[model samples]
Target: MRKIRNSEELLGQGDIASRRIVLEIADRTLDRLDSYRRIRSIMRMEGSVLHIGTRSWDLSKKRNVYLLGAGKACNHMAMAVDHVLGDRLTRGVAIVKISEETDRLNKTEVFVGGHPLPNEEGLCASKKMIEIVDHAGPDDLFIAVISGGSSALMSCPIDGISLQDEIDTTDILLKSGAGIVEVNAVRRHISALNGGMLAKRIQAVGAELIGFGISDAVGSPATGDIAVPYAAYKSTPIGPDPTTLDDARATIVNFDVADRLPKSVVDYLMNAGPDKETPKAFLDNTYFLLNTLPDSCIYAKEACEEMGIPAIIVTSFLEGESRDAGTFFASMAREIQSYGNPVKPPCVMLSSGEVTTQILDNSSIKGHGGPGQEMTVSFAITAAKTKGACLLSIDSEGTDGTTKVAGGITDSSSLKAAAGKGVSLYQSLREHSCFEALSAIGSTIFTGNTGTNLCDLNILFVPAIEGGR
Candidate 1:
């Protein structure tokens, strides 16, 4: 705990208490995320569905454990699965979005695919997964691991459209500011592996399927049922910004590949019909939500309060488009500095949620940034002369995008750093290079992998000003 001031009343009544409560809840939520660790904790000798903690369950006698992972924690989940089921893990395959691949699977094979959009790699990976699923027998166990970035990473689209079409649709939805549920709704339509599509395929193969899910969305249902086709169906009114297409193109490939198609995914999309099925009812053995954003929000809030600063948790979960959310947070921070409406001086405002960044296409252009840190940096630059105001945002899983740093942090030094480099803060922000801007100034927070995934956390602090602003 980093106490920045002195006042028990403020500690108990004001922002500190609010922040502490939020962080406490966040921490408790985080405890559930040890599910991966629990999988590792339970040896094959342990009973079926052995409980390690609340919501953390494992099965030792899962005849032939098959690993199917997609998300930020996919590799971690695979590692944990391999650690426990070593020889028992007869086969494994997981996909990470392009450039999002962090760790190599311990005993499992890992594949880097696509995200925010699908690409050639994603298609190939999907084919490989289908092959693996096709091989599962009745007694063989299929552990389907899913997380936030699964849609793009585990994509296997319908027959007529190319991966590029999927990518274009994704771009439209992302720019529209549609929520994950809504985005995934349309995504599930053309995607062969979305909704319960993958599970249905496994069922077709006669494999006993068990799904392990980690929710980045606010409410974690059985399997993000509402998320499958929500975005495409209910695209947000948010219009597009003038962003370069080069960045997005940099990691994608598959304007046109082949005329090949998996009969299962294609038939499922058509025969099962888009509107004919519910999204999440795909896997019978399902465990949703190992950790979530609210959990991280509470934990960070508490830690802020223990430091003696005033803190308030305005929202337990925060979600939406990355840039828009960042700008909104900047306004809230400014308010705390000037008027002190929601929270007073010497305090921190904390929140958590999954944020999506519109991956721009780039050829000659070059930049780097992620939702978390970019939000913080952008907020700091937008600060209305609140000299001591500091904001920190981080992705709980350690890596933010393709970097080692979790995200960005901002304060007076940010302005100084920008000025020193002879660059305007606005320019860095406009370039969408907040990650590098902060990293160059040595302001990015790095916490490799906390062995937990709790969405994202945002911590904002306002030190006592000369006259309380």
Candidate 2:
């Protein structure tokens, strides 16, 4: 299936050739990073033995097999495992950001949870997972599928902390312009399920854990030999947490959100003793690293090569304000087109990372949008100087911020198109309403439940200058 649902509409406007190339690369890259296909390739069942990568487990010797997962990509990951285990799987519980109609599961129960913020439904689903784990014994086997956004999708706050507190904390951290690592640091400390706390619980019961994880952390290295056991896995609910309580406290102080965050969260992070720290390591559990942040760029570069388009992976660690990044891409396009500084024009620049948008006041939000939408809007404004320069910025998980769409695609003509429709791109950025502005110009890209979550995947296509003007 096509990952870009609105490709036809997106291609009809501003720099059609460039938009087509950007969308094509994006479509192929998303398909390559699909967790469902990746999981199926490395896991299967042979008689009573479970084969994953280079390891094999005799289920006949185990009492029961259980599946537990939560994340934006859990729908596909959990479905793959459910199909593999079949009836041998005793029970399964998966909390996903959006449960698609295409999802088919036999024994796994699906829960539609919130992302970017924890909700009551996620809290309930988390409680159910805890119940399942508490009853499990040493003879039981657990297969965990974890990915980015699990921190919010599987929400179970520790004692003295409320679910709303976690929700508020997440919202605050996301808007505070703090990087995802710092935000997760604070979140992992207060949650009962996150920061390897769930793995600790399973370990306490002596249950065997086999983890399939996709690391969305920025600057995460590319994974190799995914079938083998990964000894360096960390974070999420199923692995050891690399973050410390001190890190969490430091984030609060650094972002200066202590007054805005819930008092319960502040008090817990400040006063929690060393015993309250999240698990540092888990030696007994087995883990398989699937995709990382750089995988998106790697796949995109290959796609560009297949299309015979020169492509350069600028950076996999792109960060900072979203609008500024867009402007920078525009400047890079100008240089590439005029002087071929980085690379010649008619080339594609690929980058993957988590770019943030800082909104200090809630009253400033007039409509809705995310970092991807804002970035594309800003690019459209500055890219007018370079003809046929197109940019596509997406969350890569199919949902960009508050909007239902994946992200936005815009080119040099996009700003003019917005003006024709009486939509002010500048005012939209100021109001944090890029979704509305892009939607008016038919530039929004919609792909629901993309089956991957590697944060932002940015593609910039700069066509050769028409007349050197």
Candidate 3:
């Protein structure tokens, strides 16, 4: 694993030791919980026996093994699978966001695609994926690598829905602060391969399908029911039923995303047809969760302990507005400084899970930042002038929103540094321009594609004693 590129700059600007500790924890967590490493740890091939978690597959019984995957982490995960299966793997294709960072594979072809929104490249790649799967026979094995951005990266619009329609709908949902469940539900209905539709396609050819899901959708009730190392044949279908469609419509209305939706989207939703429904049943399919947010948080906590720093995971299922959560954590740090309750100083606080940023309508605001950066700025504002506290928030995939930077790291001096540059933190937050504000203070966290996505990670470091005490 590569070091976060902006680590030095970030550490240089904050309370040096505290920032170092926070970065160390973040780097360690990233290293241990990397998607490829996690996959490699659980999978191995010995002669004809292939071991994946607790289950073993005999190569003698299987023929024509094809690998298909998509997501920010699928490149690494696919590479790992190729290494394990070696020549036994027939052929594969993986859609990823970064083509440059992708390692060469013997049998797997890596396709660079768009994220957060699907593009022409993703559409093309998804078509190739469908072609490959559609050719599978009864004796074939289809291993599907699913992860965080798969919904966007593997986009193949269903009939009557153009790529533009999907893009418009996605943009609306993202800006509306809709959760993954609702967003994915809407996507599953419009796409040709989401939900259980992929399984349905493979079943048509009598091929056996298995899903390796690295869950970025933490706290989802669906994840809890899945048995570890067990292949689930049944997947919840997202169809155009009255209940599901109503929920989808309600989400758009509730979030005020309806106005931005394209005419095609509105027409499709309003004039629902059975063709838009994803198949609920499949002949042969199974699923397993490879990694999750709590899994990564546990790794971070363990790493902190290994460094002799007392660490506690405050929560692994954090959600809600990003700024609110940021302010709350900053307040917690201040509380720790003023009083020794809830574990004293010299400890690291950890949290994981996705958060949302409700961007208010501002046509003039052109800010480059994500929810992670927003949280960092909010923390800087609330924790100003308070010494011995450092906080770092990052999207695990290394890209926060559409910005080039991952997120931001800040200390008590962060606000002072921005003030020195005549940067107003409040104005930045108001305009949702955290990227520029943190960049000016040399606090932006930059890591070019960490090759993994398991939600977001936030670390707070409180020193043993306050400054000047």
Q: Return the top candidate by TM-score.
A: 2
- TM of each candidate vs. truth: 0.72, 0.99, 0.91
Q: What C-alpha lDDT do the candidate models reach, one value each?
A: 0.57, 0.92, 0.78
Clashing pairs in 3: 232-287
TM-score winner between 1 and 3, please give it: 3
For residue 111, what is the lDDT in candidate 2? 91
Question: Candidates sorted by TM-score, descending order?
Answer: 2, 3, 1
Candidate 2 collision pairs: none
Model 2 weakest 10-residue run by lDDT: 460-469
TM-score of candidate 3 relative to the true fold: 0.91
Q: Is candidate 2 or candidate 3 better by TM-score?
A: 2
In model 3, how many backbone clashes occur? 1
- Candidate 3 residue-wise lDDT, 253-322, digit = tens: 7777666888777777767765655565443455666666687678888989899988888988898888
The parts of candidate 3 lying over 4 Å away from their true place are: 220-228, 231-243, 273-276, 279-283, 362-364, 466-469
Best first by lDDT, ranked: 2, 3, 1
Off by over 4 Å in 2: none
